[model samples]
Target: MNDLLDRLRGILLDTGYTIDGVRERLGAVAAAALSREETVPALRATAGDDPLGLLIRLWWLGAPVPARAAPVGLPVAELAAAGLVAVEDDLVTAAVHLQPWESGGYVVSDRKVRPGDPALRPDHVVGAGGASANLAQLASRRPVGRALDLGTGCGVQVLHLAGRAAEITATDVNPRALELARIGWALSGIEGIDAREGSLFEPVEGERFDLIVSNPPFVISPAGRFTYRESGFSADGFCRDLVRLAPRHLSSGGTCHLLANWLHVRGEDWRDRVGGWLTGTGCDGWVVQRDVQDPAQYVELWLRDAAEQGTPRYRGLYDEWLGWFEAEGVTGVGFGWITLHDSGSLDPVVRVEEYGGQVELPVGEYVDEVLGAVAVAHRMSDAALLASRPVLAAGVLEERIGPPGAEDPARIVLRQTRGLRRSVRVGTVEAALAGVCDGDYPLGPLLDAIAELTGEDPSDLRERAPQALRPLIAEGFFHISTG
Candidate 1:
């Protein structure tokens, strides 16, 4: 089996069937179209005598290929025997979807059971998608002793954890997903992963990991509809329980990273709701709510995600799911990443805020940096924070704006050119402080210097400087010399 996989990989590489190769072959327009789940452009681009093209069309795009036309170096018979491909009549069709996923090499998962089909099978397996991709980007790549991927569908996270973690464990409730993930690990040549079958935290009971990552079945459903997504749990209960239980499963300084959806109930603040879950969890949290949708919009969005919006049973299913939300008194659903750090500090802080917009991925290092900033701010007294030397982050840029014909700028904006792409408008003191933060001096002395120059009261300057700087440190705009 290993030899067969090696040969298969050799064939894929030699024929230029990798991600970059495919993207180069199909231009940006076709690639974008494929990302939207439209296969027409990809089909048109890959239709040729090109070996890689044919294989891509057959294996990835779900187009059937003549049996005799199987690419060279791929053992068609062996793959068929392995149940990866099915031969019917004179044509061969792939039983699984194989794509060039990142993390050392490609990953495999079940293809859509039937494209354009309204209803999904209960055992359907979710693949490497936007959610998983975002979660990977959000995961820190720091080396760890033990790592766990909860609900590891198709082994995408397991494949990612291969080199970074000394020991890796992957779990899932669906046995078929585990089976597919085992096959994926084998094909990708990733080993040492202890794949187990269970729901969130059940299989790994009493064992703590240095890092835990989950892009779990987080979709809020009417009931458990698809095995890949629905948890059969109550509204967002899986997410809530996962967050609440993470602290118990984390070693000191460990982290539990998750992608989730939380309900915004009537007469309740969203931040308070999310913050309430973190209470007694013994972990400092950084929650970034990327988006929010009303009940109807949430139902419609997920219905479309499941590819059921335009089908014959769309109305009935939509009504049923919407009814569930209505009965639950959910006003909106919030989608985002929850980053937890188990620093074991008694006074743990939970930063709950919404950061909406496009930011760079795998901001894992940035995420870690934010946690460090939080810890530093927590440990330092007001005087110590003001006494620390500060430098502007590398990506920060300043923008001054004013109404037309004005000699002086009316407002100043400090924006990050990379990593989170954060931007904020600042007042005179902050703008002045930003211009001089070259790491040459401590913030306290800097503010004193500014007061000397501006004739403001030093007491007032000292009082407000740390408050303005604290957020910048936490958000990565300012890098302080912690050592």
Candidate 2:
């Protein structure tokens, strides 16, 4: 079984087809099979309106050939138990399909999302969605004793975490979601996952984990849907509660990775707003505001989602979303990754880094790098304490600006040359550090020299030096001494 899984992973990776791509193609195969079935009307009557589930069943009937050589003698029950398919009320359903044996898992069809039969559950398992994949890849893949996946939609994150953690527990508000997760788990042949039906931590209460990952019901609702996507709770606060609850559920040295949204209030700093969420929790948190949207932008994105769900009146739905934002004093909304590490520090490191410009890397990879960077940053001390101190090249500058229509400058700007395109506001000490950092002496001596030169406190200079060096090291404007 391990050999088969390894071969499958190797083939998939070599073929350049991602797990999501293969799952999507499999869904497409199922959809195409159902569309061509002769007894579609009969199945529709039995299945209600879940086109996705209907397709899954149709694929299972041997009509839609998932692969050319269909692994003859493989039991359908085994596949279901493995989480590849679902059999409900005598209907066959497949969460994913494969067309041919490529180097890796490959699907040659356009995947589809089908709802389930009305009697079964409202929020049926989706094959795999972008949000789930993003959150899964963004999470830390290092070894852990136990991990918890909240709102484990279709069990994608659970399946991924199973490889890294000794044990994994997944939870969702809907029972059907657990069923779907089970199907995905079985089909993928992933192990060590336990699925439960409950909202958030209800199922895992008093059970602490080394890592917690969630996509949650982050889709801000106009009016809540009864199924998987909605929390029946309001925006911002809904995710806030989930995060706040995580600290208690986390073991010492544990980490919680969340994909969340927070409303940006007018005249309020987004960092301070998110920073407030991390206070008194005995956790070090890093929040990145990946993207920001105005009211119209926010409305349009979720409006498309409702329309996809066959909701009527697109304009009305848009209006409702706008009304929700207005009533909540939300001028703008920011979406990003939030990581909380349970380090047991009284004053833990809580930093907010914004990725404002275009990201050349994929979102999942970018988020993964962010987590890796966080882990690396945790191991290192203050920049001044780093043994591998950076030797910056000469083009960095401190530019001061003049007040509008005034002869004197308004403020000092710390600017870097080459790589990362980073800049900062230069305080008096930072400006002094920049001027003196010629890479000859250690930071302590430089601070002493500067204190004597400017009649300032040497302790203050020592404390402020690391702040200036951080951007330099991160931006590659300063290269560290490996020696």
Candidate 3:
């Protein structure tokens, strides 16, 4: 099988059939095979002697999958050919293509179950999924000496770490997953990863890393049928355990990055629930809940994961999931990213940032900047004070939120009657301008100008400037111009 896999991988590379192309073509072949016996030959030809594709075709022949069933034994070379992936180098590869699909709620990677198809095997090693890729790309790209990818699925995050860090280790509890991760590593040409087999930190205990990362098995399941995606705990115990244990394996100044889900238990704040995981760890942590889904939506999404459509199994699974949520008093589920830093601080900063609204900027870069802000906030004495020095000149407009239930509703508009028509939220005179500014003047001068224009007291304006600038500064609408 290995030899066959190797040969098929070579052919796929030479032929330039992308992973997506393979999936689409394979799915097309499989669909045809189920509907008509003549299509089996073409499907087999697509696999050629590739064990993974062969496995996928066998199942598709038996029953038409929902197109969401995971693909089995995907060839890396094929994925590269698909333009969905890029070969980073002789060492360290990445999946740069998952972002666009991820935004649309699809995991466009070699490692996904065929879209809308369910007969494919669950453990099939495909390209890195969207969530895994998202966490990896958003991981700090700064230089680090050592890094660990916890729950290294297909070694996607490990691949992202190869060049950024001097040494890398990718760990997983599933041996099959470890092998697949190795295969991905080999395909990516990344080396030096100690592919250890263990759940979370067990394999890397006593060995600390400058960076520890994971996109763990966080889907709370009644029965953990899928080892790679689903967690053992019915109440998201896997994530809690990972959070609690991650601090122990970090080096001083080390950072742990991950994407996870937590149940929003009734009568319990999500922030407090996650904060509990960081307790006793002494690590500064930032947990952002990107969105919350009701139990019904959660069940439907997971059911769609296996391509189970209108099946009694789905109903039973939904009941079980709801039962688990109900029994635990969970009203919703919070999904987001967690970042922990073991930088050795007397008072670790723990913040739960919420981002449920629509965002205009590219989210990955925004996530990176926020992380950088966290790092800066830790080091700086007064962020507001530092921001006042040499600000840029950016025009900001104040758009009114609709007037409260008035007969004639007000227009929500950005009225930028000055410099650049940049829509930024700036409160008051100086602070509003300063918040929307591109760092053109001194904080003192900006406040002075605002006081002069708005008839506010200068001292009072100066005092209020920082508060107004906080929101604008957080958003990149106000950038510090180094020129």
Candidate 4:
């Protein structure tokens, strides 16, 4: 199997069957259409007999191609024997979805179940999609001694962790997902991954890792019909349990990145509800709710996800899902990323907030810096913070909005142009403080000078400035200079 996968990898790479290659062949219109799950335009674009074109049609569009069109050295018979493809008569079709990921590797999973297709199998393994990309971007890229990809469906995250982690362990509850993941890893030429089969944290019992990442089956659904997206546990219990159990398996200073959805019940603050998961975990946690949807919206989205819409059971399933939400007192569902850093501090900092802003790509690059800043600001005393010199982060711009020719601006806002892209409204004193925070001088003297210029008492300014600046530091707008 390994030899066959090696040959398959060579054929794919040599034929330019990659994400970029496919996009270029499909062109702009066809590529965009395919993203919407409309494959006619793509099919039309790839009607030629080119090797890349034929491969795109067979694997990506899930369309059969003439067996004669198979490229030389493509081992069609061997692929058929391995169940990677099915050859009937003069046509060959892919049995699994072999996706060309951006990381220069292929992911093997169950073929996509489109609308009007049969209902999904009980143990269907899903291909890498938006959720997988989100968790990948959220995961820190620092080299680690050991890393774990929990619920490693199709092994996409393992591909991302290939070089960064010295040793990798991937675990999943479904044996089918594990099997496909192994196939994907072999095809990608990634090795030495300890693939274990068990439900969440059970396979690697009592072991710790330098990093753990998961895009778990976090959909809050009444029926656990799909193993890839629905945990049998009730009402976001899987995500909650995953969070609470993370710290136990995290080595000191280890970090865990997860994409999850949590319930928004009546008479409960969603912040506290989600934040409660991090309590007593002894980890500095940051939970950001990127999007929220009402019960009806959530139900419809998942229903459409399984391609169940327009089916006879669609309305009944939708009604059943909504009824479950109502019975569970769920008003809405909050979807977002959760990052936990094991700081080994008794006084751990946990922040839960909603942020809908444009952020730069590969947030993993600076996540540690952001979390470190937050921890420092959280623990620092006013006097200590004042004595320290801080610098404004790059890409921060000051915007003053007001009526034309007004003496003073109506509002002053500081906006980050990169990574998180957070914006905050500020006062004159804070604005003045931001202008001079270049790490050349201590914050105390700078606040004193701003106080004098703004006609406010230096004592009062000093008293209020630390609280104001702490948030800026926490959100990556201001970098507390350790130098």
- lDDT scores of the candidates, listed in order: 0.85, 0.62, 0.61, 0.92
TM-score of each: 0.95, 0.65, 0.70, 0.98
Model 1 lowest lDDT segment of ten: 112-121
Clash count for candidate 3 is 34
CA shift of 229, model 4, Å: 0.6
Total clashes, candidate 2?
25
Q: By the TM-score metric, which is better: model 1 or model 2?
A: 1
Error of 4 at 64 (Å): 1.1
The number of the candidate with the highest lDDT is: 4
TM-score of model 3 (CA atoms): 0.70
Question: Which tens-of-lDDT digit does each residue in 154-248 have in candidate 3?
Answer: 66676557767898888888776776556545544455778888876789778888888888888876777776777676578899988888888
Candidate 1's TM-score: 0.95
lDDT of 1 by residue, 185-302 (tens): 8767787789899988999999999999999888898788887888988888889999999889999999999999999999899899888889889889999999999988988777
Task: After superposing candidate 1 on the true structure, give the runs of residues whose Cα lies further than 4 Å from its correct spot.
Answer: 113-115, 404-408
TM match of model 2 to true structure: 0.65
Q: 246, model 3: CA deviation in Å?
A: 2.1
Q: In model 3, which regions exceed 4 Å deviation?
A: 1-8, 19-127, 279-281, 310-312, 343-345, 357-368, 374-387, 390-424, 430-432, 435-440, 475-483
lDDT at position 254, candidate 4: 99
Candidate number achieving the greatest TM-score relative to the actual structure = 4
Better of 1 and 3 by TM-score: 1
